[model samples]
Target: MPSPEPDDLKRLAERIDEAERKHAQRKKPPPPTSLGIAFRFATEMVSALLVGGGLGWGIDWAFDHWSHLQTRPWGMVVMFVLGAAAGIRNVMAAAKELNAEMAAKDLEK
Candidate 1:
């Protein structure tokens, strides 16, 4: 077999270096728009509320049927409030993350 040409090897090394540079430079995802942020917050809150309410409903049903206890509306109400608190917490966490991201971008510039 013939040995590779030096010119050919040089070109190949340059191409490999270019490709590596391109690969190393990752594209960041676009920041969320205001509407997107709003939707995210809303979804978080609604999903939490639904999960909490469902759990409460299940608890009430189980107590009423299995143990001769009646929880009914009170259980639902308490769970709903807890769910609201959880949702608020989620929103705050999301907001903090976004703020940090924004600060990072600002620092980069």
Candidate 2:
């Protein structure tokens, strides 16, 4: 039935602020480690290669079986190169994003 004292109010506000700060920190995700980044890049590259090779193999098979054309290994080779390029591009983009994140974090500090 009584109002809170001034000291109690100030302490309560400080506690609330501290709790909010801790909550905010908990909500933030941890930064990626170097090993994690490397693995991500490798996974991207390998997945791209697999997709390109699979598509190329399918194309070669279709051509060989349905028509007179003979793509054989050339299709796989060319697609593989394209996949490599795509993988490289993806890595570059990821690197750029990480750089931006780092810069932002640095600025925050």
Candidate 3:
């Protein structure tokens, strides 16, 4: 067979470079640490709890201020319960998100 010319070599090199780039693009990323996941979950839980408490307190105060509605302790109890539920929901959501994020991170490796 005839020797490959300079142009052929250049084209081959270009093809190799393109392949490498494509491979890199297809490569997966690394996963996150266990500690990092826990930290993120905890952070979200705390934030949610704080927000829920504030909202509940505000609602309770508003209800307490209204003369006609003020007679009801049910409002306060309901708001508190709802806030706690919301806080718990947020914590669960955060945990799920954190796990997903960590899984994605691991896949990127």
- Going through the candidates in order, what is the number of backbone clashes in each? 0, 0, 11
Among all windows of ten consecutive residues in candidate 1, which has the lowest summed lDDT? 68-77
* Candidate 3 residue-wise lDDT, 1-109, digit = tens: 8886989999999999999998888644555678876787677667766666666667667867865466355555665567667767877887787678777777866
lDDT of 3 at 91: 73
TM-score against truth, every candidate: 0.76, 0.74, 0.56
Strongest candidate by lDDT: 2
Candidates, ranked, lDDT: 2, 1, 3
Local distance difference test values of all predictions, in order:
0.88, 0.89, 0.71
Residue 74 lDDT (model 1): 79
What does candidate 1's lDDT look like per residue over 28-101, in tens digits? 88978999999998998898898888878888888888996789977888888888889888888988998998
- Most accurate candidate by TM-score: 1
- What clash pairs does model 2 have? none
Q: Candidate 1 — which residues are off by over 4 angstroms? A: 1-23
